[model samples]
Target: MNFAIRALRKNEQRVAVLFIMTIYPNKVSASTSPFAFIKDYSGIPREQEILFSTHTVFRVGKIKPTFNYNRLCEVHLTLTDDNDPQLAALTHRMRQELCGSTGWHRLGHLMLKVGEYNQAEELYNELLKKASTDSEKAHIYHQLGCVKDEEGEYKDAALFYEKSLEISRKTLPEDDPSLAAIYTNIGGVYHNVGDYSKALEFYEKARQIKEKALTPNDPSCATSYNNIGSAYYHMLEYIKAVEFYENALEIEEKTLPQNHPLLATSYCNMGSVYKDMGDYLKALEFYEKALKISEKALPPNHPDLATFYGNMGQVYHNISDYPKALEFFKKAHQIKEKALSSNHPSWAAFYNNIGSVYEDMGHYPEALKFYEKALETSEKSLPSNHPELANSYGNIDLATSYGNIGLVYNSMGDYSKALEFYEKGLEITKQASPPNYRGLAASYGNIGLLYRHIGDYSKALEFYDKALKIKEKDLPLDDSDLATSYKDIGSVYHDMGDYIAALEALQNAFQIQQQTLDENDFALSPTYCCFGKIYRGLKDYSRALHYFEKCYTIVQQVLSEKDPALAIIYNNIGDIYRLMGDYETALSFHQKALNIQENVECNPLDCATTYTSYGETYREMKDYSTALIYLQKGLHIREKKLPKHHPDLAVIYHNLAKLYLATQQYNIAMENIQQAMDIAQEKLPLNHQHLLDYRETFEKI
Candidate 1:
């Protein structure tokens, strides 16, 4: 006999319970009472039992058992009574069945959904012991993998996922949904660990199966598309990421409800892609769309809402709108604080975002405070050597925290302290299994910058070379990061006065930037400026002016009118005109630069550089009195701001000696020449060209 129990709603307030029982002859007789089993099993009172029948195949057993035993005897019972006790008993039985083996699987899944990772792991492990078939074991293992993944134990999660895949391959048919699911899980682990290439590989594997097995516009397929888009986004393949995100959105728009969370996710992913591509308006449009959907479909304090706010904060930060960025960042932090624990990684991310906003606003102390909070959260939540804490793959949040703190120190002019934190980050990166080349390069670059600022040109060049070598090995030829490496090496070479090497390195960087960057990209401005400086050093005034003009045009388009960066371009142009013997034109440009420096709260060193350039141009034009005035102003500022023995001070003294000699102030010229020689001897190498020039000038005096 077969029995089927179905619940059907007959009206607004009544649920009609239908029981279809098929009985064979000799197996059970109708006169023996089908209702007897229910009475005995459930122990319900006979008066409470209300049953209505639609079909009757059995009489009181006297109607001749004409049907053979093989023939089916079907009985249908419908209970529409609102207060029937038998209905409650049947509902209890159904609930018990649901809480059995099949129910345990659902319970474990619920544990995972609620972030009870340890509990889910325990439940799934216990279920594994009771699994009878390989398919059942595979499902349990897959759930275990999910638990580990949520706990941020990526390596263990990957191993468990692979084990599940192994079992699935052995027991399931080719192209099974189980296989696709395991493949997707494995891809997620790789994605979390910063292996984008491997992530794409596994994602593609899952995608192929899903495309073949599932109908078009399946939500599961949309998930696969979203994963692929995320992998591409992290890889910095922004256009390709957009393609996949659009594919996911197309499926979602067709199959999902207007306010579905998955549709919101698709919108958020699209926003991120536009953000990375520097299309801030488009990014905000998508983010707002996602926010609208989330507000309608999610709780007020949902963590996904926090993500939307943080992303908008990042967009405002990039645009240099500090107050707006802070507003959004704080919004994100508030939501995350309410929804997540202090030690949650999401909380850490929120802290980091807030820190970034403060850093951009030049609030170093506030930035450090929030960055420290992020570090504390990460330390509390993640293991010391966990991939999320530190990994050579350059994706660890801890490494970023260390690097950001170093930047704050550097900006405060604490070079030694900056180096300390930068080296700490580098050490963590070095300890990662594969030694994250990208992280190593970043640390090296930071250390190089500190050395450069302290005037240790050789040490700066050495660190820059280390960074460049790693970038060359790890990045593609046309990658913007690789261009940055070449540009750094070129700038270091320029600082060291190796103009030939500087030209070659800068050219390499320019070519790569031309290939990879947009025509109007601000990143190209520095490279153009460097070219101008190199050409000026080589005495190619026309070529130098050409590059300087290019830099000026770009800077004017990207930055504000009073920006100090534009002052640098004007100063460079002035130097070029002075060298070309166009003294009046040179003075005009120099005056423009000087006016900007005087009007703005400029760096003292930068203001001094303009004064020195003006003095030199006056001396070339034979205006001794005016030259002396500008020279004295430059010397006074340099004396106050620079170390006493700085090579730059020696240059100023040398220039003063030449001016005095030209004016036939023989005694003062000799005195100034000797002072220049002494400072040069102390600060410059014996074989340095500047030292040789000082010696020649001293002999002439």
Candidate 2:
């Protein structure tokens, strides 16, 4: 410890830390001496030194600052012998994965495994120059292709893979297992470029070859199944994706060691599929299993471990556990920063996820900052023509980044800026080769949402229909994405004063949800909420309450009690009670809503809804003074958050007009009613229910 501290004191450039390592070696292992004490041969005989073997593995333990010095730390390490189960299993799997005919080949494979892509490429290229056989040249080409693939040069990867395939075909049998590996590589290149159909073709070819050439439970076959599953996942064919993923998992569980890293990949793949299916609990189960195995089989800062963390974060994000989600996201980012380059395409995903959590929390400026960081990272790391940035989810292309920014702008009430970014994203999606239908659908849906927010019901319907048409043509009938399209169209129709059309579209969405999701799935909550709103518009109080309660039940099952989304449901239920003339019950629910909305970070407009609901209930009970206070509070938030002519603003105006008229303040009521009339005349359809209500209130005044 004194020797290490003395050495650190000689560096004058900056503060340098000294790591005093305490190694606990396993003396019971007789196979090898992992360390040797060499005091006799030391130049400084008084300072005894111990030398450890090059390949000795250590499990890191406690690391803490010591000796009251901020820079100095004590690190505890346990040296692993051959008897260590985790080390033994990881070594065994790694040897199998990196199997090669020569030490040089194994060295090249190791370089690739440790993410030394440039070194691996140079080694393979030099080896290619000296290759004596066609098989040797083919293997070297395939390795080079892997290097390019890891470096995000997909076109070069495809070329190298094709070269290897061409040579292998001429030299080897048609059913060679080696050829299947090449085919899978080619499929991966296609997958990275967002051409799922082409990727599927190559993946299927690899699967067929593997099945014919290998045993029924061969681990190689599992790789093919996983590749096929990933393609289906990208294509939005969740059923097929699950089937293939389970097939891969079955083979892996049967053949691979429990703690093998490949098993972690299978588990993560299954988790991703479940997460997208809206089965968050199941997703977390699989992600935990994957994380446990990865912790045992890989280094602490391995990129694969980061992927597991990212998967766990995604599940928490879907369930609206923002703090837990952010915690997991930052953990993943810490690992990624250690394992990957700063501008690596993978960084975009971490940035995007954290941005999404902020967006949902209604922190638009913070969300936009992270979204722009994602865009910058993506542009720096990915090719111009690359459809998706290709993260753990294999989603979030450059187009998605633009759309994310647009969404934040839309939430911030900068509609023109939102539309500009949305249009840019749409154009990029349109230009994607082989036509990324799924991405196109999402872009169209975003634009549609922007239009709906601006009260352009006809324009919203146009874009939503375009999105729905593409989904219908490309996605399975029971796909959750298809259900989302139905929900969007339904919401627009509900806004356009077409109750029958709204009910029909919502029913279509519900049917799809029933086919694909559990009854209590969080995805079904929004559909139920939409159904409740439509019934409320029709004055069917009982049916409206029934749907609202169903929605609330699902939300309670999925989200935390204090989640901002829960506050919205509370406000909805309160308004339903008020409509049914149960003022006390309505006030109780409104209080519950305010308890959450006032304390949490959420859209000011959502908080305004609760205030307005309280005002309506109080006015009905003839509490005019309290009603005015709540109405003014709601009016202030709406005016600040929404555009001057927004239809939602008109609703608040009409509510205030009713409260003022009930108190016989005719002049003040007339002013509020005229403001509502002006907004409705400019923004809403003449026959819209809100406009009709405004007219009725005008007559009363």
Overall lDDT per candidate, in order of appearance: 0.75, 0.85
| Predicted model with the maximum lDDT | 2
Model 1 TM-score relative to the real fold: 0.66
Model 1 ranges with Cα > 4 A deviation = 1-174, 178-186, 216-219, 233-302, 308-328, 346-378, 381-395, 408-413, 562-567, 570-701
Cα error, residue 163 of model 2, in Å, equals 3.1
By summed lDDT, the worst window of 10 consecutive residues in model 1 runs over 1-10
Clashing pairs for predicted structure model 1, backbone only: 392-436
Q: Which candidate is the best by TM-score?
A: 2
Residue-wise C-alpha lDDT for candidate 1, range 452-547, written one tens digit per residue = 766577888899999999988877677677778888888877766678898999899889878746666655778889999998877788999998
Stretches of candidate 2 exceeding 4 Å from the true structure: 12-27, 30-32, 62-74, 381-396
Question: Please, what are the lDDT tens digits per residue for candidate 2 over residues 617-695?
Answer: 8988999899889988998987887777888888888988988898788999999999999988887877888888899
